[model samples]
Target: MKRFAGMLLVAVGVAGCVSNPGVVKTGPSTYMVSRQGKTGFAGIAGLRAKAMGDANTFCAQQGKQAQMTNTSQSSGMPILGNFPRADIEFTCVAMGAE
Candidate 1:
């Protein structure tokens, strides 16, 4: 029983050293805007809100805009977030209006 527990610990450690194995690429692509927001106001009794997706597109359709950011890969993977494309996220934020 002790030997089995030791083997389990070793396996868990090895798994941690392995890279993420579930990220999928949609082919040469960009970051699809996952969400959107807006703010405004009218009279004290008025209200403001944001609409998702392009109004020219549709209300039922989800909102999304693709901004090409991912540009490289390492170890046969697109190192997105803290790994490869961290800058892309920052750049994307800069593109948005404050």
Candidate 2:
């Protein structure tokens, strides 16, 4: 049991080390992958919209989803220079979750 507790502590420490909202990455492309993992749910809808393949179509399709939120679009890429890449938010909170 002592060994197990030590291992659990180590795992929790590692998880805490990896779970920081400040650590984020970004990229640019016609497509958008979520950075909320890095950016937080602040970006989930935007990411979903990007993943939808057609921004307008995706918005139209998702407009009614209860979880969907209105997000603003920028004329230029938000993260990188329009290159397809991803962001990882190690600190993003898991919802209704443990």
Candidate 3:
């Protein structure tokens, strides 16, 4: 009883510690955004927003706009693995001069 509860708590804590989403620059104008577990499908809208925001920020640093070019999703193993993973690909395009 008590031992089982403790184990459950540990499992939940571990699950909560899953990796955070990240953006990886594939090229000067391309990037990939990805995340797992709660940061993925469990909170899909948040993930998308975060990914887009990251891409936008990166492009902004170089004076450009972030444009989403592709997206992907996958369901992982239950409990012991990431249940859902999300990925977004984006390109940075130069903003026209005002």
Candidate 4:
């Protein structure tokens, strides 16, 4: 039973892992960030928040500000292998540039 319990624990831990691919450049000055919530209870809002944070951080690293261009999210049923996910598109622009 102990071995079964250990395996179950490991599975749970892996199930809760969040998948985030940092900012990806899609075009000149434009980037995209995507995040997935693997757990059943993970919500779309949380995934979007994390993606937005990642995009902002990436822009900050370049001494620019992130201006969001588009945002998308999908609600998923984890039991069916679908996981909540969010994607955000943004552009890094000079400070005060709209």
TM-score of each: 0.21, 0.25, 0.67, 0.76
The ten-residue window of minimal lDDT in model 3 covers: 37-46
Pairs of colliding residues, candidate 3: none
Q: Which scores greater on lDDT, model 1 or model 3?
A: 3
State the local distance difference test value for candidate 2. 0.33
lDDT of 3 by residue, 4-65 (tens): 99988877786778875577878876799876665323765666677678788888898898
Worst 10 residues of 2 by lDDT: 23-32
Pick by lDDT: 2 or 3, better one = 3
The CA lDDT of each predicted structure is 0.27, 0.33, 0.73, 0.82
Kindly list the per-residue Cα lDDT of model 4 for residues 1-98, writing each as its tens digit.
Answer: 99989977876777756567688889977899998877667888888888988988888898988999999987545654466778999999898899
TM-score of 2: 0.25
Candidate 3, residue 25: how far the Cα is off, in Å: 2.1
Model 4: residues with Cα > 4 Å off, grouped in runs: 1-18
lDDT of 2 by residue, 1-98 (tens): 99989976765554444321322123221222232222222354454444333333332443421122233332334232232223321212224322
Model 3 scores a TM of 0.67
Candidate 1 is scored at a TM of 0.21
Give the best candidate by TM-score. Answer: 4
* RMSD of candidate 3 to true structure, Å: 3.6
| Model 1 stretches with alpha carbons more than 4 Å out | 20-98
The most accurate candidate by lDDT is 4
Candidate 2, residue 93: the lDDT equals 20
Residue 43 CA displacement from its true place in model 3, Å: 2.6
